[model samples]
Target: MGNEDFKQDKLIPIAQRSFASYEEMYRIVDFLNKTLKEKYNIMFGLTKNNKDGSMVITIYEF
Candidate 1:
């Protein structure tokens, strides 16, 4: 709607992650960590989703 809102949306988005197994999840996390750090110079955090037993990776910019 507005320029400020658009910029905020670009900063953070709601995403969903589902994996068939823990190994797949770990692989994805590792890949993302490497890519983000090497290309964008960003670091991310991984956390466990207690409700669904899934993993969540959050990358934020300050």
Candidate 2:
């Protein structure tokens, strides 16, 4: 992608949290994504931390 497409203001990581299991993280992120995505312009993502194997939830603003 070009520099303009990778602007810092485009995607911002606002918050993050660690969970014990994928099920727990998925539930919370799914709920937040559905409830807040349209009205708040926010998104939630889930990933596993490679180092510790913990579930990570990331809150992003777009």
List candidate 2 stretches off by more than 4 Å: 1-9, 22-24
Query: Which parts of model 1 are misplaced by more than 4 Å?
Result: 1-23
1-62 per-residue lDDT for model 1 (tens digits): 98645544555433544433363656766788678754654445567777777766666441
How far residue 28's Cα lies from its native spot in candidate 1, in Å, is: 0.9
Tens digits of per-residue lDDT, candidate 2, 1-62, equal 87535543587899998867665667877888889877988888799988888888888887
Q: Cα deviation in Å at residue 40, candidate 2? A: 0.8
Among all candidates shown, the one with the greatest lDDT: 2
- True-structure lDDT of candidate 2: 0.78
Per-model TM-score, in order, reads 0.44, 0.66
Alpha carbon lDDT at 8, candidate 2 = 32
Q: In angstroms, how far off is 1's CA in candidate 1? A: 44
TM-score of 2: 0.66
